[model samples]
Target: MKPKIELLAPGGDVQAIKAAIIAGADAVYCGLDTFNARNRAANISFDQLVGIIRLAHQYDCQIFLTLNIVILEQEFKTLFNLLNKLVNTTLDGVIVQDMGLLYVLHHYFPTLDIHASTQLTTHNAGQIPFLKKLGVSRVNLSRELNLREITALAKVGQEHDTLLEVFVHGSLCVAFSGLCYSTSASAGNSGNRGRCSQACREEYETTESGHNFPLNIKDNSAFFDLPALIEAGVYSFKVEGRIKGASYVHTVIDSFRKQIDGYVATGELTQDGERLYKVFNRDFTNAFLRGDLNQSMFIDNPRDNSNNHLVDKLKAEKGESISVVQIHSAQQQLQVDKQQITSSVDEKIAHLSIEKIKLSLSFASELDGPLRLTVVTEQSDSLLPGQAVKTDSQVFTSSSVMIPSEELSVDRQAIEKRFKSINNANYELVELDTQQLTDGLSIPFREITTLKNELLSYLNAGVAMIAHVQPPKLEHHPKADGPLGLSMLICDEADVALADMTDGDIYFKLPDAYKRGCTKYVDFLLQNPRLIPWFPPVLIGKDFEVALNILQQVKPKLIVTNNTGIAYHAEQLGIQWIAGPFLNTTNSYALLALKQGAACSGAFISNEINRQQIKQIARPKDFKLLYSIYHPILLMASRQCFFQQSVGCEKPRIDNGCMLSCDKSTSIKNLKGDSFAIDKQKAGYPSIYNQDQFLNTDIINDLSDKFDGFMIDLTNIGAGDRVSPDKVELITQFQALLDGQSEASAKLSRLVPESTLLQYQNGL
Candidate 1:
């Protein structure tokens, strides 16, 4: 008989922890008071963590502590000291994401088990052996894998005799689990090591038409097949809800438990288990797991402000249960002929005629329907449970055979239709090489205008604004003249105060990065009355203090704080605040939720979003257009930069920070002391080296028409590195082109002029 799979639940708070245990969870994962994954959760203090561990152990349940957040050099001493104390406690395993942390846990707490967090983005089989060698007991596979992919991966784990864990239920991320820099790009909060602002939850507008869209919704509101993945033989099932209420966590975990049991016993997903999304799915999306769904998963529109009927259906089914059972035989194992099976309602008999093997089974049935039995054969004659089975038929050997379930059938048409009608928003203009700009790029202007008019023609169209793409440029110029026209300069107040001349009206920015520690500077600028302070997202703990002392001392025109942190201070001060794009106000709910802090929020649309989805968000709130186009999401590191040392990589220092240089670009990433070149491709695209960049030159003109400010995301630009001539040139030319000085702008107009220039323009 196979070992029973462990059911793990997230405990963001103490109540959530209790709920998980009550819901029949075998184990619960939580964070300590400081430097754990949930920065906002009222995490367990050191003493409380120890108490929780003891309490969990008393219940015969296991407790997995989270030391998963990214660590900095300064915090190493304290972190290791904390780890040393934890070693004496009943910590079953450490759920870890950072390689540096992994190294520490292994060296100091060598007896401690470690489970790789999903944040590690362990997507392929190659990582298994590597992790296994590092004393990792289990791996949480990337959430983006589909049933087939996950099952295939499970086979690898089985062959290697390692444990595999997967997200069986709860909130699903739109971006790749660990690869997303959306939070870091929008705000400086990093999610890789777990200080995230949940930026993906915000809404945005489409690129073609500036229609607003909301991202906040229930879990599984998009297109995930949780039931299918559970049946794929994952060793452990994980539920994501560390930030949610206890009821929500309990409801989600209990539901998945039933689903897993049902599939295991009956070889079928019970209706209640299959439809768990109806309980609390924001919008269901299998993400990359189900291949690719054509539509955005969460589709609540702010403009309409109507409750989702789909969500309502799910909510109605909340707390419904599903059940699964473990099957075993009192008699010996059964045998079966090729493609043959035998079973009774009360008992099951499996016979392998060729091997002359037979087995009998008896177990409690969890399904509401009839008891079903299945016998599958493998490639090799060794019939071991959890091992990959291949069909070694004399006729021809194949990979696997499935025991058919009477209750399940594949719906080809439903799957196809679901794919086709996913999301239908306007297309964003691809950044073109102005150098490659020809009649093709120019003609798109007419096409976009036509599209705008066509959308507005219908009263039911619900289109709000058209997202226009602005041309690219490198530097900010106050005065310029040409055929293009006047340009908008996105300059900081420092730039304005330091400039020799102030003839042109430049949009003054209060960069959340540089001016974060100074309130006096903000007060001085507000007194000048000449500054247009465009505030971005602000931090909560330290930066919050900076905003309070001097924010009310001066009356500023606008403030932006995404949905969290400093915006609260800005709003309480009665200043007109414009919400930042980091808030991700994709729909009405998001807008309403974020509106308490700022009067207006900026909405950005990705190429994957659709116009209808945009309309879903625009109808609710007053949004001031920020940058029409968003550059590549940038990774921001609050953790210490990995520039100078090899301390952790070699000896497993408590403080692990290292620099990584690729052929394309140089970057610093935090990892466990036992880190290696896991996968350069995943660390990020060679963005600085030209492998990936958000230089949307072709779409610039289109974005310029809809946004109040155009943007260039340079957060990833290394602090010590020299300024990028290409970026400066891109901004300079973009301003020139926006100002109608086409000749002045022409130099920086194109990116990769040789490839897809014409083809992309034609598609637009």
Candidate 2:
């Protein structure tokens, strides 16, 4: 039989865990108080984690801890200590976003399972084998995958024994997970570090039209696609909401649980669309799953449109049932009232009741011999509700003394009654076998109950024992050599003209959206061996193949990319590549892992890391490290054309047929009156850049020895100046600073009054 698809729910806190398990979740993924993706959520404390795990295990449910955030080098010790503490607990697995964290966890706790978080942006099958090599047991695929892509990955997973998990319901990110830097760049709050400002949800105006929230994509609900996902070999169906309330978690989990169960049993879905909507949603879309990019997926006006009548009906029904329970205890009544806004009385009742212990019994006897009774207990398989019987070897078994001869003539009905008398609703009799006891057999009611109690006690003790088993320790390696060099990222021809002014290696950033004007730079690039071509970070879907073809034709010295798909493609095309900042390389282990790739030359330290944190990175001594010293920080890169969406342009520039209206300077003003420049001249999508240039001349001296070179990113600079005076002046000052000129700082201050240091001094 096929393994039942798992329904994994989010447990934001202790209350959320109770709600999810009571709602019939097979597993609950939650974060602890620290180092988790949803740091904003009221995560459970260390004191509460053990109790929650025990409670979930009692219900035949699993608990997966979320350690999915990117970890910095300085925090490695804290993480190691946390892992040591967790190794002694009953944590079923850990969902991780950092490759370094994955390596450490896999090495330290080899027996513990590790799931690659969706933040890893694992969309293609080619990336699966590399993840599998990293000891990842499961891969939570990126939400951008289509059914065909999912199927291909599923096939790869099956061959490698790595499970494929997909998000079936959740709020969709406008930018691909892990690749987005908007919040970090604009607000200094990184999504990678669990502090997203949600700049995508803000309103913006286009040149031809007024204001609208163009980047706000709708929530994803694949309720009708459960069977299709299962057919595609999805090992787990995940629901994404870590910061949501308990009631929302319960309703969503319960609704999906019913749908999955109904489909598994009868080959048909049983959707509670209204209830799911009422739980919480901006809007709904299955566009990504269906490969329908043209579909209207954005929720221009995000509002709750749930049916009020349905909500009222559910509340009224719950009120009637809970009134009796409320009358018993004033404290319970208060709790019930508080929870009523989030959950139904049935859900509350389930939470109040402790999970039952599952047990099985068998009776055997020869025609002339004495009767024997056997009791077995083990972990429950909730999916197979009625078939909990286990073999002698599979469970802790205790045989009772043979039935007395005098009991042979006892009433058969009486024996059956004794077996059924186990009460408190705390014991689920999975199976009972009575083969040779057809004539008659009697057992005292107290004796039968005593045996059941003993088995429960044994199972409970076994659980504690299982939790204490520790994996063997592994060896740890210290810091090593890494690549050393200075590099520059040039975006425009003006920046290209000034590239030679600075004494540094240059890399031309290929426009995200291919532009006709970029062709003019080809002759210039061919003449300069120092200038390498850098690929865009947001390549996926059809654009991925197109970008690959373009890069193949360009045939530069080496390629720099942020997307893993591009890295994998570069390997196939026999092109050398360097890991970009979007890959989130925060530690030495991740750097080592990336270097193992055939195409990878080295990696850039994540821009999110502060000076002190970056200094702690233990990369190979010779590994090249490119630090961004000067650049207009990228706020966002969107596939939806802002001009077309907001300004009512009949054709977006992405279509290649529209007039290049974005060639002119365009800026979006935020609530704070900070204007972000928009460059739509790129190939696939346009990017938004922060108004201020990020300058770090003060820290260059300190970082120079640690890093091989600094990257001067000149993308989207000098937006308002007609003669590009700001760009020229900024470049001139930067060149002086690189040349160690004494007046560089004063010169830069005169040209630019205010600049952002952006995570250089303070880490997020």
Candidate 3:
């Protein structure tokens, strides 16, 4: 049976949230001013979030807050405080990315529903149970999954009682969501933290294929695929754009709402979805959903296509070439459409309010009588300045008041002082009437405090007061004596000799996608026992099965994998596996989750953190921590081919053969004269890398005691224009640096002069 479809919308600001509610969104996901992924959006405040929750629930729409960024060690205290406040509110759920937050919420704030962020990069079926075990109720599926893949995962999700959400309409990221490090490498901003600079949309120097925006693709839309998505059993259809304004949010949500309703009721899509073009968009594509990777997905223009689309439509209507006057006319028509959308949204949302609720507290006491308190809450209105309509009232009675001798009498001042803190994000408790308390009757100070707490509990709709949770005290587990042996990554079989000569473990880099029933890798791994199989970050459909087959056939003692699907399966097979660097391990609690979730033996600390951040992570008992000291800096990895618009591919679309035969390398220079390497390896996805390698030797001296091992990449996949040094020399020098030889650093620097440690310095 198909799951009920939920139309989810984005709310960047107050107006956008209101617009979404009026436009008939079933659910809306927004971010607050802090701790949320979208720092660029005009995020709301805590008070506004409280008020917005009230307004949205009135319309039977749910609200999910975005706490979708990776958690740092030092920020956990503030994170806990925020969670404490959130647990007391009527918030529907929280969409989260950090694993540590999951551990905390599952333990402390059990009432808060956890929805896995798309930052987790959930794609394969294995990830379903992996996240479900961590208390995830719903998951935002990866943007790259096709219909068949979605159906398969949704089936698994149903078995685990986990809901799956897909991005049906929005801007499409060129790379996988959690994997891209484009701005983080160049600047301190990380997409994992929601400070993406949109490097993919930037205009680049023209390539041989005559394109300026080679990396930018058209926006995503599945208006016609609603039937297929519903048949796939997906639970939610999300629209992506928290940075877009109310007009854009309202127009998109309203159009999708009618389309979904018409299709569900009449079994037909009445709307042609042309209204979606009235607002901001790059003309849409559903190629990713249809599982057809084509050249048409790449758009030369990254900006709004509405004006251009209108011009084209006008040209077709007149059956003539586009004139300058006609172009101006089209621009005017687009503006009128935009203004009409804005006006319509403004009118619809005018009745909804997010103002702070006003509290009227009345206190009365007589000689030897129990203290009496009446709490009345009124809905505040800017239009009604002096008067407010009562919304809620509750009376709280306490133990009998005794004659006052030692403690101060319960006067108006004492009553006001006891409960003033209720004037907070949820309410304003200013109108206090305590005329009868002047009779000089009082209770014990502790009793008064308890009565105040009871009032607070009553005001919060019968929720008991939650005590602040202090940070858990964890015992530091140091690494065992003796280095866990230095390591190097290589893609070729000929580099095995360097491992023996240099005294380092050799890891064989695997391909992202593989042909079905291929046994070449299985045979190669079986023959060469020295090389440990290192799995890539992505493996979908037949590729995952082939990779799993290799794992079963080879039965190696150990493997390194970046994909959680592989990690999940390896844990069940009892194969010792190390969580690769791409897993984005940051805080100590994340390490604990990995160990408990998969019995993981070791993991590579993400290079995006600095020395201080690295030292703060407390290693789990018997688990080894490692770091990658040297490698080509990967910016993005994409399912779509960059060569289609960069160097020009003759094929109109890419298929499995493109993965096995196409190996192209080119560099695109930005307007600032900074060049990025675009490399496409055979049987791998196209990737962008920084020109300079990430060579950070300081960690050797700065905090060597914190890690058990170090790694260097000897693969030539990311070396675009610059020729790499000999693999043996790289191994020798990196090994010497581990041995504390001072001169080895200088020697390695001379060999590879262009390198960067921007991520290490920034310490996200």
Candidate 4:
């Protein structure tokens, strides 16, 4: 038989975890109060996590902890402390996004399994070898991949002995995961840090038309593609929604469970797709999964919330008064018997409890010897978390007796019958081994019953001893040093010309949206021998191939990229690359890993990190680093076109062939009354920038010695709140600051009215 495909469900809290297991999920993924993607969810505390893990294992369901958020240098200690505590529990594995954390965990906890999170942006097969070398047992492919792309990557995974995981159902992000910075730039709450404000789900007005939600893509539902996914060798089908309530969790999991089982048994789905839609959805689209992007994936009626009747119908079908207990909240706990309404659904919840101990048994009865029975009880110790332990392997012997063959022959069948009669609701017989010595062996039936009772008592005692094992303390790591340097990222031809006039060995960054018309300037800039082309964060399919062809023809010495797909292409083309800011390089180890894995020449520190955390980064001698001082921080890069939506265009506007009918230099005002500049020139996708410009001239002097150089990104200066339209004046003003001119700060304030320090003083 083929290996069963795992149905992985989400557990937002303890109640959700229980609901998922009872609803028939093979595995559940959950998070604690910290270090996970869903920070807004009412996550379980560390104390509650231990109990949840034990409970999950008791139900024969695996629990994979979510440590999917990026980790700063200072947060390492807390992460280590949590992992140390988790060593005593039965956690199946961990899902990680940061390469540094993956490296540290794989090395320190060699026995634990590691899965690469979708935030890694693993869309291509070329990125698999590097992750496999980092000790990743499974890779969660990016949701942007189509069916053919996924199948290709799955084959690669099979060749490398690595597993592939895909998100079959979930809300889709307009920008690729880990590539978006909208929440961070707009609200100071980064998606990478698990505090996203969901800036995508907001309203904005276009220059030519009225207001609309152009960035809100519909939720993805791939129920129809289950057979193809399984056939392509996908090991796990992940359902995304850690912030949803228990009723939603139970409904979705149970529905999918039935579908998966039905597919496995009869090669057909037994559940209705409408039931899944009724559970909760913005709209449904399998665009990327089916390799069809031309379809309309956005809902015209975006905010109706029409699934309330479905929740009531499901509640009526269950026929039980189920009260979902909020054990962690003191106020909610006080009203345990009272029905509480949740945001996703309004259904009553009831609680039920059951416990069972899984064990293996062996029996030996010789002709002239004692009847020996051995019961091996499994235990989860800190040193052996998630691994089975035989706590009681020794044999218990009974008195031997001999009798005539005709008297009362205790045959193998008789002995087996007696053992099967031993019953207990809390005990599960996993395996049974028997030895027969039936010749001239006669024993009374009463003796067999007495032996079985004694064995149960012995097994119970061993279970208590194994449950009390404690975890061991872990050791700490010391900081180290590295090299640093400076680079400038520019958006247009004017900024490139200004960069040529600057002093020192500076590199010019070509915008990700550079078109064929811009090639004339490339030869002119190449005279300086320091131009690096930047690839967009969402490169895949034909776009990726086209970009690869262009890069090959240009044959630039170095490239800059954020997505793993581009990194793979760069490596294959024999070009050295640098990690972009969107890669979220927070700690020193991640820099080292990228340098080795992606052949990176240098890296830029993430804007989300604080000044103190930046200083704490241990620099390596060969690795170069760059820090940005001035730039219009990117709020979002969405596939949806605000201009097209505003103009009432019905067809999907994905490619550049679709005309941007709005004024090119226009800005959009959000609900918060803040205006963000929208640039639709980049492949028809809108790249939004914060209204306020980022200025950190005060700390340049202190960081000059530590970093190789500081950066001034004048990419979308005109779109910023206050800035002169003259390119030369802007570049000269930034140049004065880089040179440490005393009057530069005063000049900058006069040039730009409102600016933000942006995490330079405070961390996320």
Candidate 5:
């Protein structure tokens, strides 16, 4: 028989985790109080995690901790401290998002298996090899991928010896997972940091096509499609609800458990998916799984659809709209069913406790013989004296001898103090039974430490103690003071003339989608040597291949790429590459990681950070730091059509033609009366942008000495019907500002009057 696909569930807290384990989750992924993407989830503590790991192992269930946020420079010490403690535990794996964290984990904590987080925006086949190179054992592919794309990537994963995990059931985001910046642009809640404000779910003013929640899509469900997914060679089926309560976790996991087991055992599903509707959901859609992009993927509401779903089902059964009295009756029935599920889950998990295992350490010593220690783990019920030992006892002999001494005698107090580490996350030193040995015995202090280390090794399943790692001191390689250069981005043929206006570099923006075997980009780059290629953050399937082709053909001296897959390819081809701003480069270590790991020449500091955050970054030698001084504030880019609900597209669904040929624009205003531009450029994905462009002159005045280049965007992507700013005058003013001309700042502020710099004041 083929190996059964693993069922992965979310564990938001101790009770939820227990609920999942009891509900038959093959594995559970959870987050700690810090450094995880789901900050809103009731994440567990280190002690809880340690105990949870022990309890999970007893049932043959694996626990994977989520530390899947971009690490700040100051947070490394705490992260390292946590990693040090984690290495000693039998943790199954860690899910990661930051490139720098991957570098640290791969180099220092080699034993911890790394799973790439969905935040990596892993979509293309090239991304598999890229992450595989970074020591990722498993990858959670982008949630937006179709079944065909997922199957193809699963095959790539098999070739690379990396496992693929797909989100089988979850809340759906209209925007791509890692790329959404909707809240970060104004609310200071960066989704990259796990503090998403759910901008996509917020109510907006009714658009021209009449949508109040334009960005909200229906929840994703692949229950009936498990057989197909299993056949696609997927290794893990992930359910996404870290912030959801234990009741929801239990219900969803139990239902899926029945579905997977029945299908695997009998080649036929046994459970109906109706129980899934009893829990909190936005209804369910499997359009993405079936590779069908259409209007039905979205729902009118973003709240719990369970009550309404029941009413709707009842009405549909009668073939008409139900009365208020009938609706209330149906909704009340849903409430009762949900209550029963919650009660059942609570009762089943009442005996499952995550409290630290109690330990009784007995020390025996006589004359000069080596000291002996016996360890017994008491049951979770707090076993009384002389009660049965729930676990086997292990005896360890010390390498050092104990001598009779009156001054420094070995007592319970001394033993407890010396073996204090024994009362840690996994084990609680509840009792120190030193009655086996006579008093007035002493051993060398270092010998006490040695014995403790030995006992710890035994407690950790005979694994040697892994010493805490202090990151090696990076050389303070500050660059020589130099004036920052001006760089401009051009997306149109008309803006190419701006290159002759200044001696500064010009970058031609590349499209996320490309026509198959397209040589136009290669020819364009070849003809325009002055224009450097600027690769976007997202490129999947043949589009990635086309981007790589452009690189291989033109072989530019240097290029800037937001995609790490492209960065990896560039490094392999011996071509220098700059890390784009969209890569979310935040700290000094990230800069170091990019340069050392992929030979990155330079990187643009993330625009999401404030002045203090930017100033704190230490530049590596010979690495350039570029910042965009002016550009449209990008909210998000999505594979789904934003035009479907905003202004209403004529086409029923999106296709390659829509991506490569469609050019449309619309706007959606929120209840706060803030407008967001929905723009689709020719040969580009649908995107949401802040109505105002980002224009910051303060960074130039405050930290010009820290950067190698200051860039301005000349693209007219998010302008909509707004009047265009003069490209020629903008270039001249940016250059002058870079040259320290005080008047240039005021002139440029007038030229770009309709811009905002809110992100500069609010750092993540």
Candidate 6:
């Protein structure tokens, strides 16, 4: 069934919002001037946002606030306080891009609905069920999905009882959400944390081209691909023009409105939707939505004199043959033929002409032989009833074009292969969870065994990993499972590797940097052989030379870095590498783009993706699913962690570097008591640890199909949110979901059943 499509628009200021709403938008998303992810846009003030919310409500429209920026520890207090006040307002859920913000909001304002920001880079169906479990009521599917993929995701949402939102129209990013670090990489301001400088908007190409051509050359140009997606299946059609003028808002919204209404009536959108494109487009190509990034898509000079004629020629070619192919209405249908016409014999509908037939409620026609077109209209015309008609040959005479089989083959293979793997082995382990007592109290031994037994049962039930929120001590202690490591207990990064290291006794892994350069560590690893590195940091001293020195001496298995930095250094020293989370790769092209980027062994990516998207980003052989799922994906180089800067800022107070105001959260309730911001005063360091976007085992199963291993991150777990048993269960369930499934499999979350401890041992 066609969705009740909503035309969502961006509104940076009052004018744009008014223009978009007046132009027939169903919803609008924008931000506050201070903390919104799009800091540079003309964001409204808090007061203004409230007013806008009320006004939109009055208009029977919805307002999605943009708290889409990654937050710093200092900002939490302010953010919490602000949200505390806003929760009482008439606004709908805020569009949140940051996981830390999501956690805070979920803890304090669980009743508040959350629309996962596109910045989260949610690109797969497996991600939907987990998002629903995380209390995400609605999701803005990633901008990267093509039409067919979105249709499947919509099906997934319907299957899992989740609402899917998508971008109908918007500013298309060359990079995945929050992952485009060009600004942060060039300057010091990180886009993930809300201070992007739009470095991709610049244009420069290096004359000296090495083995790598385009990447070695700088290419900064705006790219747009909104229209085709809107015509597809994005339920909430978003327009990317918050920074644009009211004219832009009005024009774009009007064009989109027409297209959406057209789709509702006819099921097809006209080609070359140039309304917004004319306003401001970087010579649009369907971005990667076309399945390949063609060179023609890059618009080098908007003012190039030849562009107009070229565009005109393209438009002329596209519009050469407009034919009435088909019409569809309840209980009525008509067919058109080049030679003649056939009308449905309902006498009331028999009197429509070709033009009226084109606009009738039901009709069908063969166009160019292979193209079967169908259209539906709101009302039937009696003056000229639906009929079969033929167009003048002159209409299509000049529009003959050849279709490239090679290009079609490549696209078919890419999309088909990506979808084909979805049915591979998969399942999810669900664990009963309890809140963590920060004072480090352990759970009762009897309770621990009961949880362990439940995990073992699931493993026996063909579940690969046990997912639960038990402390590492309970999950891994020899006595917990009677000295046998049954199926692996899925765990976050803090514990997964750590458990392996301590003879399967510890769940949290320590930093491997201390272990890498030391001979003692190497000898110990050689002896133990079962140890694994968790949350390993790539130590870059001054530059790659120091890293090379360490690598030669240590001969560590993996070295990680950003693509550019890694490319520069790796080229100097020949070696395979791992793309770190810092790279922010969210699609296949980016993954392929980075294959030789640093000669990566595997790539690290943000957890904002589901299995299908991960498969696209990394081929089966090269992807590593590190830190499977963390709530609120954080983009920080450990070198830049606020804790490393100072010791005294741990006390919560208004200070620089903090983006949140905690005072406003006093009235807001938290599931885990009143959650407090990290105290920077006593610790001499900021208490706010980086928040991770929440992900679960089901999403991990999707990851397993695409990547080699998982990284269950619990860094924030111990520091502030601290890895809890629930988070650990999430990891365990992911493993159990994958262990023995023959097809894409999932264990519907059955609250961990009561069971007796069963011991089974496997030697490493």
lDDT tens readout by residue for model 4, 599-709: 777777888877778877776656667777777767766545554544444655445444223224457676667777765553434567777778777667766655766
Tens digits of per-residue lDDT, candidate 1, 1-764, equal 53477888898876677666656688999997776777777666665665556445545668998877545434556776676656555578888765446655554567678988876556555456545655578999866565776887788788777889877666766444554554343234556446676643544333122222322333442113544555576777788778766655666666766765676577666644433432334544454455543334444442222124333443466434311111112011112210121122011101111121121111111222222112222321222223333432111111122223334321232223322221122111121112211111111123323433333222112333233322112121121222322222343334444323323233444433223356655666666665544443322223335444445666665544332334545555666655544433333333333443133344333222223333222323344444333233333222111211211123221111111222122332222121111112111222211113334445445534434445544333222232333444555665665666657534654531311122112210
TM for every model, in the order presented, reads 0.43, 0.73, 0.96, 0.74, 0.96, 0.43
> Residue 190: error of model 5 in Å?
0.6
- lDDT winner, 1 or 6: 1
* lDDT minimum window of 10 residues, candidate 6: 755-764
lDDT of each: 0.45, 0.69, 0.87, 0.68, 0.88, 0.43
Over 561-631, each residue of candidate 3 has an lDDT whose tens digit, in order, gives 99888888888899999989998888888887788867789899998888889888899899989999999
What is the lDDT, from 0 to 100, of the residue 109 in candidate 3? 86
Candidate 6 structure, TM-score to reference: 0.43
Model 6 has a clash total of: 96
Write candidate 2's Cα lDDT for 48-95 as tens digits: 776677677768899999998888776777777677667656689999
**How far out, in Å, is residue 417 in model 6?**
69
**lDDT score of model 6?**
0.43
Collision count for each candidate, in order: 111, 21, 0, 13, 0, 96
Write one digit per residue (lDDT tens) for candidate 6, span 1-764.
65576778888877677666666778888888766777777887765665566446545678888887655434555765677656555567778765445555665576567887766656554446545544577888766555666776777777867667765454555445645443342233666656766533333332121111111111211123333444453566666767766656776777777766766578666434644434544444453444333333333343322234334545576574523331122112211220121111122223322121112111111222211112222222223325334321101111222223422322222323322322211111121111211122222234324433433333222233223221111111111112212122222333444353223212222231232233443454344334332222222222223333443444434445432333334434564555556444444333433443224455655443334433333242334334333332222211111221122124333222232122111011123232222222221222222222333444443434444444444344223433333544544554454454433223323322211111001000
**Candidate 5 lDDT, 411-516, residue by residue in tens:** 7777878786678888888888888776888888677788888888888878988998987676546656755678889988766777887776789999999999
